[model samples]
Target: MAARTVSFGIGFRVGGSLSLLALLAACSEPLDLDMRGLMNGGFNTADAARASTAPRPAADNRGVISYPNYQVAVARRGDTLAALAARVGLPADELARYNGVQSGDTLRAGEIIALPRRVSEPSPATGATTTGPIRPSSQIDITTLANDAIERSAPTPAAQRPTPQVGTEPIRHQVERGETAFTISRLYNVSVRSLSEWNSLDSNFSVREGQYLLIPVVTQAPAPREVAPIEPGRGSPTPQPPSASQPLPTETPAAAAATTQAATAAAAAAPPVANVGTQTAASASNAAMAFPVQGSIIREYSKGRNDGIDIAASVGTTVKAAASGQVAAITRNTDGINILVIRHPDNLLTVYTHVDNITVAKGDAVSRGQSIAKVADFEPARVHFEVRKGFDSVDPMTYLR
Candidate 1:
């Protein structure tokens, strides 16, 4: 192939210079070079050389300044979108839509203000990795710019992640050969009635082989109130008017203690509610499941009484298991000829149906992102996930988090 050559206008203009500066900042992008270079030839050679030497982006690998065309950054604490737009030569409304923020909203520092016709970014994965090109408002000074725009003193993401709530503690008890639920209840100083309810088993107390159970010590719940019929001549007492300062009665110390204990036990015995996602053991595959794709959640789960939920994804997109699990059942429904089912360690089942091809076999264990299948049928295919306990379908949204 002949050597490629570029052309530029001899007389450079100021408008072309700033845009060229942005292009030079994002020289890695081919389209950026062609577009910005057309306007860049007139820039002062000295200034262009100076900018090339001092380049250090604070956002680990996020080169916000590289894509200068569409963005202006928040410089200091409390800078409004209007003010930032004035500096970057864009409308305040444009900035608002870029960051999904409002015009009157206060920016912290180092935020990007996406301007029109900004430089494009190379796909770094397969193409060039220009920092400046094609950045949106969300990617401005994208590193520190986005973070600093709110507060230099803002909490680090790890700090911002909500603290894990204190979930139910694992209760433990050894199984005695001859002991029944009655015997264990007496030994633990807990009521048999409470024990049956704590465990999801029937009240028959049919103890099984060598299973260790967690005994939750719960207080006896008060009997529900009942309405009694009165004789024809009897009358009910009149209700008293409410008074803000009136005090409430205090339960006896013994009753109060019992209530507290029962509450603690009940809390300990409860199971985590059903969710769209399921928890799994620590593994590389389990962690990889947090991201379904690079796009969005176009469809949702359980809109009706359906077996599973669907996630609309691009056709031919790679499908992954929700978490690490044993391959439970693989079936080709009459309608959906291509289907895959994985049973995670947590007993959660994720089904990838309507697939173009199945890469896994029935009973073949798979991992998250293991490329078990692909969406071959339509423009965007869906992966149907159904989490179950035994055969009971549970809501999956609760666990996706």
Candidate 2:
């Protein structure tokens, strides 16, 4: 009887252990995070499921959703366009018109309402990445030029105008997670060896996250100055007649002879400025394209990293077309930022991003310098401009006047 009892107890214990293990196995079945959409970019059953979810960025305290290319606000349950606009500090009618909805129309929860313009940037309080472009401290703020010009009515002479020159010092960069020495060097288009020497990196050239390193300096030659040649007769200044305010002297033989001699002497002397041409050159060159907006270039183009240049302007500044072309496409990125592409001759294309209030539609004919849109209201208020020849992007400065 004792042996039988011991056997029964062991069997019970084994059975209980098996039940527990089964429970654990059931609980450990892979969690359905619904992350398949992110893992695949192509359309499939997962994409349809993800679309129903309508995942969107969470709004901050200001009710603004911030993205690199654009921003949006999510609608709450039982909310109207007007209510959402008020919560986000935007005009109700403007918001409604931009989204193609009535002010009083009810919105579905989690529905995205694209912002016509940027409201604010992600704050540090939210723990969002607030990294900006790395620039040398010696770089001058370009807005100063506009401010100085506004303060004075007369245009400053080119010779007297202060030209902002880039300094030779290395730019300081804070290493972010996943950044390597080689990547940093590639970002600034400098050799890794120079970057290591400037920052005094160890033999391994390892950089830790949150560590600050100086970017290597690159010696760049000054661009050739474009001087509009003076035409042969155009350079000569025309003499003005005596003003009516001044009375002419009485006619006298001696005074007339003196005036004649003085006039002859002046004519014999070289003109204060020479007119080297009858008309300015109308021939087009590589630099025939006009700037999309009048602002300082905050960031220059890098082939892979930055495919275009960033020009910082006011929020409502007019953005003009770079060249005469037909509007090939007007679309939005994943972030809903407006992108305008114009198809020019020679199979070239010009792209304008971070702009709002688009005045032209797709397939519309646009002329050079035509107002196509306005700069978006971003924190820095900048426009991303690019010039593309076929599939590759080239230096915008090479073609910008």
Candidate closest to the true structure, highest lDDT: 2
Each prediction's total of clashing residue pairs, residues at least 3 apart in sequence or on different chains, is: 25, 9
- Candidate 1 — which residues are off by over 4 angstroms? 1-294
Model 1 lDDT per residue over 132-167, tens place: 233332212222221222222223422221111111
Identify the candidate with maximal TM-score.
Answer: 2
Give the alpha carbon lDDT tens digit for every residue of 1-401 in model 2.
99999999999999999996786687522222332322456322221112211112345554455543445666677888899998878999988777666899886665556677876554544333332222232122221222233223223422233332223333557678878776665566555555555555656767667555555444542234489888877968888888999887666689789999999998889565423212212225565688888766777887644677888778999999889988866766545577778878997878888899999987789998899999998778888888878546799877874
TM-score of 1: 0.27
Lowest lDDT 10-residue stretch of candidate 2: 46-55
**lDDT for predicted candidate 2 compared with the true structure:** 0.63
As for model 2, its CA RMSD to the true structure in angstroms is: 30.2
